[model samples]
Target: MEGTIVRRVIPSDNSCLFNAVGYIMEHDKHKAPELRQVIAATVASDPKKYSEAFLGKPNEEYCAWILNPEKWGGAIELSILAEYYGREIAAYDIQTTRCDLYGQGKNYQERVMLIYDGLHYDALAMSPSDGAPEEFDQTIFAVRNDRTLGPVEGLTLNLVKEQQRKRSYTDTANFTLRCGVCQIGVIGQKEAVQHAEATGHVNFQEYK
Candidate 1:
């Protein structure tokens, strides 16, 4: 029987993307360190592709930055991990409600899904039944068949709508943040950037 589609929320410990991918790929949430190491190795081995100009920093520096648990991952990491794992990663962005396909045109026959709400990530899976435990969840999908992907797309869109109605996201532009280093209040992403630039303090904790 078809199962219930649900979101597996990963911890927001700055490794949410890695953890989300880990959960979807291996049903393991503690693979962040290993995944980060893989990313570093992948980038280091291919300086031509992940160049300073492309990475916006020296290859070594980028690798070092990503190794830090405090750093967040996005498109670069997504693409790298997709290539490393040989699966098409479909990331559904809550803000745009759009699916960004990674590893597309690569003849990858397998696919996995994740949801990004600007600041956090979660794994998308299909459990054996409603309210079933995550151990019964299926995170992988087939991509070679168009019909096989139909229900998955529908499931992702339904999840997007569900999260939208719940307002389960932070408004990065207007969300308030307090500098953890200085305990100074800042409003919105711009102010946070300004605070970081002015005081060289990048540690911020969001507040309602």
Candidate 2:
């Protein structure tokens, strides 16, 4: 099987929106016929001149428009660091894979054929080899809305207060999936809170 792989990148800063758009334009210039048509149509229908038109007022709207395959062109499989103004946030990866199989064998004999009547073969024998190259294509997209005017700080103090408050009640454990296959189990709830508060750091305890 064969397929095209595409990726798009958007910066976390609004000042870079035009740059991101430019990147997409350049990519579209060399895309395959099918994808090129899609890109051209989307741009022509909704020019990126006005911020509100392409970059909606709400971060979600912009994300939905860009990632929706049906709405926008299917050229871009992933976008990264896409943000509007950093409140609502989303980060994800898109990937596609394709594979092909082939069979090879020769017919036995003219009049007399070797049937190997002494033994029988399983149906799996006719199948292709288990080893095959897996096509892997992936794209990553992250978006966040900027709400605060200035950089936020004071993480250590905030963590300490949170640990104290939680300690006042009781220790509770929490489990979170770090990624696709990793599970992080937080043990000693109070200790974990205290550690986070004191060091402003959290570590994932991994398990299968």
lDDT of 1 by residue, 165-208 (tens): 78776678888888898899998877976777688677788888
How many clashing residue pairs appear in each of the predictions shown? 0, 6
- Among all windows of 10 consecutive residues in model 2, the one with the lowest summed lDDT is 113-122
Each prediction's whole-model lDDT (CA)? 0.87, 0.25
How well does candidate 1 match the true structure in TM-score terms? 0.88
Model 1 CA deviation exceeding 4 Å by range? 178-184, 190-208
Q: Compute each candidate's TM-score over C-alphas.
A: 0.88, 0.17
What value does the lDDT take at residue 16 in candidate 1? 94
Model 1: how far is 98 from its true place, Å?
Answer: 0.9
